[model samples]
Target: MDSPSRRPDRTISAMPQHTPPAPVVNDPATTPSALRRHLARWPTGVAVVTTVVDGRPVGKTINSFHSTSLQPPLVGWCVDHGSSQLDDWLAADGFVVHVLSADQIPLATHFANRSADRFAGIEWTAGLDGMPLLVADVPLRLECRVRHRLPVGDHTYLVGQVVDLTAGPAIPLVLQR
Candidate 1:
């Protein structure tokens, strides 16, 4: 697979990184921010969720991808209510979830950005039902058809049945945030 950095992918200017003070666990007052900080200690596998939007490929970087069931081969991920791609994702018939490798940080960052043309010059191909799949040596790729959508709290939970699966890279990409 071609590297996005070597090609003409949208680049997001790096923002300054600062570590906030961790909240006291013993304290009774646990704010939302504190809860977030506490959970950031546990890293998750980074995933890039891709689907077609009006004949063009669109993707979003996510760390919320997880297995739902084994009996029916179900998987799930969440999208924030405020995400611009929420409507497109919710309406998509099928999608591809590319679990990134550690070396695919560039791809993850590209999809996470707010750029309208995330796939500009990025190598990709069509999967099941014309769903877009990134041309990367990822850890795992699941071609899924939408099975359920449950709106809960600030994000909508999307569940799908895995119609196809592939594996490539060895090292999985994990991040605290």
Candidate 2:
């Protein structure tokens, strides 16, 4: 049975028919400008990447997660080079991805704030890999083990082996910036 607190479903049945078509602006010399144009057209969901780092909860807001391989059940995300949370996550062998519900805006905001100790006063449990499991009410969660790390440009690319997954039909939080 679904939890009583879960948000009522308000999903759209079909894609809006009033959307405009993409414009074609092909210019090899303007690739950099064109790339920025393309990036502005894509939308992505947001999530908080969390784990226990040296017995302390470490988390950061990210929108870079994506499935990499289904055969091996792999997922990946990129962490910026200058993030203080990056060092902590690099030390952790595993971590949890908390797919926050729309109602978790405050939780997301807390983690995004540079001055806030996001985990303080928040209830959580240790996962199988010693990663911190968020206590917030959400529809989906994933626990994954770090399988590989590749440095790309100014970020660290992490490939995680999905160890577990859970879903409960909850609405996901989205990021527009």
Candidate 3:
């Protein structure tokens, strides 16, 4: 047996050294350009939110449509701040959310154009509160009244309370960046 004082001391240099990992770049994703590009990568269902103002129809193609609640039957979507029809939608008594079918890509494109007449040559019928409901073969339709409006960044978040709904067997249109 070796005496405690006789034991050889282990050199600190013999121990392994761990280097710290490089710090991650704190690039914020909330920037408008970054958000748009990043969010574009995610696929989303397509829809056209329509409302009537002063006896005329107005609508825009939207991919932000989503359900928020079921007990009170709530749904939501966002309109860009630059949209000219924002006031119409905000003042509308109600609006219709027409979930486009997979074959309705042309319709979506038409609505997406800012300078185009969206309702021109399109078939639609007046629904609750005279809101125009696209007559195309959509998979689902929701008639909703304005429930809430929130200003978020460069868009207005519009929450609606569902008043009426219809569903069909058509396949829903999906869009991706």
- Identify the candidate with maximal TM-score: 3
RMSD of 1: 15.4
Where in model 3 is the C-alpha error above 4 Å?
1-30
- TM-score of each prediction: 0.81, 0.76, 0.82
Off by over 4 Å in 2: 1-40
lDDT of 1: 0.89
- Candidate 1 vs 3: which has more TM-score: 3
lDDT of 2 by residue, 61-90 (tens): 777888899989998898988886878867
Q: Regarding TM-score, does 2 or 3 come out ahead?
A: 3
Off by over 4 Å in 1: 1-30
lDDT of 3 by residue, 1-177 (tens): 989899898666555878987765876666778888889999999999999989989999999999999999999999888888888877887789999999999999999888646888899998998899888889999999998999998788999999999999999999888
| lDDT tens per residue, model 1, 1-177 | 778678877769878988998975687437767777878899899999999868878799999999999989999999999999899988888779999998889999999999988888789888887888888788899999999999988899999999999987479999985
lDDT pick, better of 1 and 3: 3
Question: RMSD, model 2, all Cα superposed?
Answer: 10.7
Worst 10 residues of 3 by lDDT: 9-18
Candidates in order: C-alpha RMSD to true structure: 15.4, 10.7, 11.1
Full ranking by TM-score: 3, 1, 2
Number of the top-ranking candidate, with lDDT as the measure: 3
